[model samples]
Structures are given as structure tokens and as C-alpha cells.
Target: MVKFRYFPDMKDNNIRNFCIIAHIDHGKSTLADRLLEYTGTLQAFQMKEQILDDMDLERERGITIKSHPIQILYKADHKTTYTLNLIDTPGHVDFSYEVSRSLAACEGALLLVDASQGVEAQTVSNTYLALENDLAIIPVINKVDLPGAQVESVKHQLVDLTGCEEDDIILTSAKTGKGIPELLQAIITRIPPPERDFNKAARALIFDSVFDNYRGAIPYVRVFEGRIEPGQKMKSFATRHVYEITEVGKFLFKKIPTQELKAGDVGYIVAQIKNIRDLKVGDTITTLENEAKSPLKGYKEMKPMVFSGLYPVNSDDYEELRQSIEKLQLNDASLRYEPETSEALGFGFRCGFLGLLHLEIVQERLEREFDQNLITTIPNVEYHVTDRQGNLFIVDTPSKMPDMGDIEMIEEPYVKAEIITPPEFIGNLMTLTQEKRATYVNTHYLDPSKVQLIYEIPLSEIIYDFYDKLKTVSRGYASLDYEFIGYKPSKLVKMDILINNEPVDALSLIIHQDQAYYQGRRLVQKLRSLIPRHLFEVPIQAAIGNKVIARENVKALRKNVTAKCYGGDITRKRKLLEKQKEGKKRMKQVGRVQVPQEAFLAVLQLGDEK
Candidate 1:
């Protein structure tokens, strides 16, 4: 048994750059763990499940939220050594942007499918993304040892997905280590190595970046055209800012400093980048002395599909929150935010996310990593509003919308959604989409048991509780994938939430006129339930401009003033009661209602309960 070793003169032809792409919980991370063990990257004492997943949230949820890059050495035939760089990508739809970024840096991908579950929605979507990137794909059927494994059936589906012959698919149980050696052999033979060109001008693509308090922004790059070394002055092709490289290294679960990085290498370059903003992800880094003529066809900017307001629980911490968000933005290029103030929530940022899950993950990271407590308002989608003045503007928050009297048109983003599920739930799915204002487009049978449903639906509808309900209707067997089609005109109005006649800007929403009443009523009722009773009467009203559509009052707490005058004269008691009533009226005039955080979150689950 020959062990892996680092060879100084490893040829470019011996390098294989690939990524593992699959649906959520189909064992992408598990397979990654096995590969690291087989290649002697980590000893028995150092190995762990999902060793590449660094975040606590990912470990808890058994999911991969971020794309992790790792390098391993594999020795084959007990003689020759090979260098392999593998990027492990997230499988959830919300993190598809992460997958896209990983795909941009690789030359091939392992399209993993579950033998029992067959092909899922994300599997299809990611396979298409890999094809679009012109990546060589090796189809792998994982968990073949399961009792319910449908090896023959899944192989047929992979044939449709990859257009490959049935015998070309590799079957392996990543847990039991079955067919591990065969898969490694297939990778070396099937996937083509990256082309090396050290003679060209040095160019590297910033696929991702991280902020270091000491060194500043450390960019994770893929060397494209030439080689980069320490002490070389490199300038950002996008920003035109120059800096000398301080260090460069690769990660084998941990950063190991290297003297230089050549073409086709994926590693980190530390130039003591201070701002973090200066090293933008997807930007190119080139040598100032001999710069590349053109930048790599980089990744497209990922547009956020959902928008929400994130405010600090304590107003004094606003500045710290801003700083924390900026640092987080360094790691997440898909996360977008801007300074925004709400009359009710005070100063905060209006953040944009790829989806609701992305928003939730960011909030968790902020709270955990920065120790910042945040209040998130109702999630909404960016809308295009044409005012009465004929000016078109984007409104991500309801507070930014003009009054109903402005008399203008509005457009909301729409998505073409694909759902794969068993045909038994067709009726329930139809009803579910109907309630969400989804238009039926087409349906096709993937095989005999699975049916693929396509619908054009508003982006807003799919952001909320839809994924949960989708699973419910299909008995946890449904998978969804969607893409933004374009904006479509809709009759939408801004519904405001008021507490004691003062509008709560954070709780406002832009809803279709037909749904404004019902949704507003549900939201108002939820607020009434979540808010505690105050000394003064608090009226929770959902209104359109001035006219109230739904109202719920939290009755003021009362103290028995008459209890003190047990046997007093009737006139005396009446006088005391009148004085108490007058005092109560004055308190109502000057009093402020302290709404709890739960009230702010009520809008998220307004439609969840009956």
C-alpha cells in the first residue's frame, strides 16, 4: 500500500479539479469525507463526519450552507502521485449561488444521485448548471447499500440527466467504502486535468473572500492564466488597486503556507487587504508589470429574491450592527444591504437575500458570530413602482412606497418554479398553487412514478412557508427549484400596521389588493396575540393609508380603585371613579406601546396557522 505524498514537480496533467454536486442530504459531504480518508489527507484520529463543514449551523441542520475547498493527494498503482482539488458545494436552492461560484472554479463535477431517492429537483438544476459551465461530469449513485435502493431505476434517470450510457454510472456506498478505489480510478481517467500556462500574464479569479482582523481581506482565488508568488505586485482588474502578495497557501482542512501558486491551483492569497471591500468576489487579480489583456468571464451578480428589514434590538448598537454586516458581506457576495430607518424600529438595514433560508442563516451568523441581537421584519420582494410623475423606482420595503393616491402601476417579480413529486399528490398541489396565485404552465412525467410540475408564480409566495407545505402535500418527498423569469404587472397596495394609531413601518407590507384584507386581518390578529397588554389601551390596526381594514385591541390593564373605598358614600365612590377615568385618559394620550419582538415576527407566520 503506497501512501500519498506531496511531490514538488507534480505535472499539470496529473491535477484534477472537480466538485461534488447533489441534492440536500444525498450525502455530498459524506462522500467528501470518504475521499479525504482514502487519500491519507487525515489520519484515523483526525477524521470526522462532514469535516469540511465549518459552521455550527450547518452541523446542526445536517446541511452544507457554504462551499468548502480542499486539496488532497492520491497515489495510484503504488507508484505515481496526483494532486486533486475538490470543492464541496451546498445542495439547497437558496445556496445555488454558492454552487455557481464553486462551479466557476472547477473543470469537472461529480453529479451524485441517491439510489433510493432517485434524482431530485436540485440534482436536475445543478446538473444543468454544470453543463452550462461546460464541465465534464461523472455520475455517481450513492447509498447503494440501502435496502430500498433502486439502482436500475436511478441509473435510467441519470441517463436522462447526463445523456450518458447506463453502464457509465458509478455505484458506491460512501459510508461502507464500497467501490471507493474504482471511483478514484474513474476520476483520474474520465476527467481532464486543467491546462497550465505559466508563460501568460499572471491572472487569478477571486471566487470568494474573507476578512482577517490582522491581515485584512484574504481572497480565495483560482489561478487562471499564469503563476502568482510572494512579493509580486498584483492589482485588481476590477478595482485597479495594487498590493504586494504577502503569502499564499492551500487548505487541506487547514491552511498550509506555500511559496507560490501556479495556473489551475485553487488557494488563498494574503496581501494584507484591509478594507475587504477592495477584493470583490468574482474580480480578477493580475500582475501590474504584465497584466492580462482581459478578465475571465466571471460570475453574474446574484440578484436577491427576498428583502427584509434587520434592526438591532438595542438602538445604541446600530453602528456595531452596520460594521458586523459589512464584515459578513466580505464572506457573502450574494448578501446585499443598505442603511434604512423605520419610524417604529428606528435605524437599521434593509437586507436582501437569495431566499428566506439565506436571510435566516445570515441572521443566525450575525447573532452568533457578532453577539448581536436583531429583529427581522416581514420578508418581501423587490417591486417596480411607476409613480404618478411617470418615474420608475424600485421599492424593496413597503415604507418606501408612495401613498395609494399616487395612482401609479406596480410590478412584482415572478419565477418559473419546477416541482418534482409523486402523482398521488397532484390534486393537493394544484390547490396549493391556486391559493398562491400560481399559473399552471406544464407537467411532464419523469418516469412512471414521478411527475414534474411547472408553474409561473410570484416570487413572494414561494419565499414563505411554501417549502414546508410542499413537503406536507407530498409526504416529505417533494423537491422544488425555481428561477426568476421577469417582472409582471400586478394590482398591489401597501398595507400598513398601526399600534394606537401610529403606523409601524417595520410591519407594513405590499400585497395584492385581493389578498390585502385577509392577510392583513390574519396579521393583525397575530399581533394582538403576541403583544402584551399595556397600562393604556393599544389598538392594533391593519389599514390601507387612512382607512382601517382590520383591528384588534389589547385591552388596557385595570386596577380596582373602588376596592380602597369599601364602605364610602355612593357620591364619594362616583367622584373617585370619575377622577380615575380622567387620569386613565391622560395616560393614554402620553403613553407609548412597547411592542415585543414576537409581534415583529408575527407577519412571518400569519398564514401558517388556521
Candidate 2:
């Protein structure tokens, strides 16, 4: 028999690796806190709101930004013990890729459904993802303490929707800790143990990773088989790079180095790996002896779904912004970038992100972490353009689009969306969706007073602040979920911006021909307000195929800099210019005015007027 290594062989069958999956605001984080409290992992005085959501942005936005894994000890019989590895995942569509990776690291999942909201689109989608991963689903109907909770009804919905037995459903309020102990027991009973062939070479999966200034890149891993110790030689399955494990440790809400880690435990490896690209989530790590045939499969690198350009508000801060991006990239592998230069905006970066929230998170982090200001371009979707001769190019920025004569076919992505809302707002919701070029697929009554409306809509239609608009139209009663279906032929035209009748290459866009008129007018109106007044009046025009669909004028500046500078005043003006330059150092200069990136983002919602 092949020698199998074991480390800290603390009871094999008493450990559980699981994640809590739920829709946004369904109390996943809260449930995690309650679990920590009940398990004595946290003292009552030490408990803070949403401790797992450690990032400031997450707490402010009331969303989980990253997947957090915590280990807790629980007891059953007089001598029985278990180590519960609880992975708390982000509850947003933008981070679904992260969710999938987190799910892959576990053998089971706790599907948390809000008792009052029942089954939402995200709930169904995440549950389906978990099922697809073959995870043992432990359905937990949470928020039962809420006044509007319909626990029994939600239990039935879980049974009907997921095909899980009604008796399998566990009613728990992560808030009041009601049914928490039972939920814990159910986890111990229902979840299966990790299967591993200790005889084989040590193999593990990296589900999470972060950059540590002191130790380099620390990858959070789950050992599938065999044992791993500090100083063990290993190679990454994806990058094919070899490294020595500098340290092996477990997360005690924070990192605590342990001597060794074994199968079924979630731990971190301090490898000399410095770059994020070297450590991929879902990539396998294995020993050289009896090396595995291949690394673990099913690891798909994340692709950026949205494109935008970021420029420093001040030319001086350009390098600072670039440095900030590099540091951010150290931790965020999902962000993609390429350096871009514009005649009007100078040097900037064409950055790509998973989605709007991902884009906003990066921007916010840059400002908060680096304390630098930037100017960002409007968010846009990628399009495939083909020339008459069949040459094809994927264009992300409208400024990079080829001339009209060079393109014959344009293709854009489309998505299938399911929106659930109250019956009273069906007409208004339908009208809003229709105006956004959504085609009705089907509608079903989820309950007597609630409805699920299915629509096949162009991804471009909803990519720009559509969720915020949907919430406004539904009065916060609607929940939406969408997935990319495929690409389709679109009558796309490049809308050009004209300042004083001269086309400004910086403000071009690719839009569908059918909606050019309204979109063009709206964009021009938005630019009129966003563009700062200069020495000359600027005429903003949106055009499609040689036709101007909308026109707006930015009136000339009435006053700008002070005309006269006396002795003390001159010093003050110099100081003011220096301060302005310092401020500009954080911003990107677009045209004459130094514009901040937040201003570019603020204009994104200009078209959502009532």
C-alpha cells in the first residue's frame, strides 16, 4: 500500500466544509455572525455587525464583497466533536464567479432563503448552481422572526422548486438564533465528509487568495487528499510554477500559522508567489511525487463583462492612479486592463470589470485606499464588428470603433432575465421593460399576489444602470436575475459627439440604430451638464449614420480664473493654482478641465429621468 501522510489527525469524520448561499440581503452574513456567537467562537462583547464582511465598502453598502471562511468547533455527544468550516460568499450576481469557486471548495451548501421573500430569482439561480456542483443542499428558511415571514410557504417553495423534500427544510432565524443549534446539527447529519486517497500525492484546491505584504500571496486552500506541511515542495496546476510552502496556517478570523494541514481542512499556504496571476482560484496544488495526471478541472478564469476608461484627474496623479491599479490588481484577479492614450484625455487605462458593482467597487477602493481622484469614461459593452471583406474585430471602446464603411455586421450579447414582482406593478414593470427593448418570454403567477415575468433582453439594454431603474419602477418590490444567452446581429451605429461641429473622438459610442434618436438626445443632454464651460460654446451632437439625432449646447464660460493678481493675492492665486494642481494630481485631465472619475460615473444615470 502507498504510504499516506496524515497531519493533526484530529478525528476524521467530524469535520464539515460548507458555504452559505443566499440572495442579497437575505441575512447570510447575519446568520454567520449568529453561528459564531452560538459556537463561542466570538464573545458577546466582541460581536460587531456583519463581522465576516470586513471590508469598509461592504459594510457601507450592506453587501458581502468577498467570501470569508471561518472554522468553528461544535460538540454533539459527550465525546463527539466537529470542525465546521463555514464559507460565507458574496450575494451579488457580479461576484457569481467567486461564488462558484467558493462552492467548488465545499461538499455541501446551506441555501438560505428569506422566509418573507420566499424564492427569489437569485435564490433559484444560486441553488441551481450549487446543485450543478453536486453539493448536498441543506435548505434553511431564514428570517423567520420577521413579521412577514411565511416559513411553511417558503418550505413548500423550496421543495417544489428544488425537488428537495419538505421535511429536509430547516426553519431558522439567523437573527434570533432560533433553530440555529438544530441547523448546526442538521449540517453535521446531512453533510458528507471529504473523500480523499491519502496514498496519492497531496492535492488541494485554491478557493480564495489575498496579497500579504509580509508573506506575499497567501492562497486559501482545501486539501482533497494527503497532507501538507510548512516547507513542502509543490507546484500550481494552472501556472505550472513550483514553490516552497513558506508557512501553513488556518484562519482564526485572522491568519494563524499552524505546523501542518491535512485533508478536509481549509487553510492558507504562504507560497513565495507574488503575483495574482500565479495563484488561480480553483487551481490545484499537488506534490511532485506521484504527481497527479492533471490539475483540477472546472476552473474558468473570470472575464470582465463591462469596459470603461479611467484617467487621473490631474496629470501629475496619473502615475499614482496607475500604481493604485497595480496594487489593487494584486488582490483582484477579475480586473483586466490595457494602457490607452487619447489626444483629448492623454494617458489613461482601458479597464474591464465583471460588472457594474465590480467596477464601482474598484473605483471606490482606489479613492479610499490610494486617496487619489480619477476620471472614468462611460461604461460600455464589447461588440464584434466585421468588415465587408469578413475581417472581424472585437471593439470595447467606441473611440476605437472603425469607420462606418469598414463594418458590415455587428453583434452584441443578449441575456435571458427573470424578474419577480408584486402583481400590482406588473403593468408599470412591463412598460419599463418594453421601453428598454425587452421581449416578453413568459409570465407566471408565483403566488396569488406575486408574479414572475420572463424576458429576453439585449444585455446592452440592461447593462447601464438598469437595476436601479427597475427598483425605482417596482418600488423595491422586484428582484431580477439574468444570464448571458448568446450574441445576436444588431443594427449598430457609431454615435459621434461634435463639439463646435468638429467630431470629438473621445465621446463616440456604439448604439443600436432603432433607439439612436432618444439615446442620442439623452446623451447630448447629459454631456451638456457634465462638460465644464470653457472659452468657447461647445455644441454636443449625437449622430447615427450621418444624421444628427440630438443636439445640446454647453454655453461659454462667463467667468473662470481671477484676472488680476496683486501681491498677497498673487501669492494666494499661486497657492490656489498649486492646490488646484495638487487636486488635479489626483484627477485625469480630459480636454481643458480636470475631471474626476466619479463625475463620469455620476452621468451614467442621466437617461433615467421620469
Leading candidate by TM-score: 1
TM-score per model over all chains = 0.93, 0.89
Residue-wise C-alpha lDDT for candidate 2, range 234-266, written one tens digit per residue = 888888998887788787677777777777789
TM-score of candidate 1 to 2 decimals = 0.93
Candidate 2, clashing residue pairs?
312-587, 312-588, 313-587, 313-588, 314-584, 314-587, 374-597, 375-597, 376-597
Model 2 residue runs over 4 Å out of place are: 1-8, 529-537, 553-603
Candidate 1 residues 276-296, lDDT tens each?
Answer: 768766778898766888888
| lDDT: worst 10-residue window of model 2 | 1-10
- What shift in Å separates residue 251 of candidate 1 from its native position after superposition? 3.3
Model 1 scores a C-alpha lDDT of: 0.87
Residue-level error in angstroms, candidate 1, position 113: 1.1
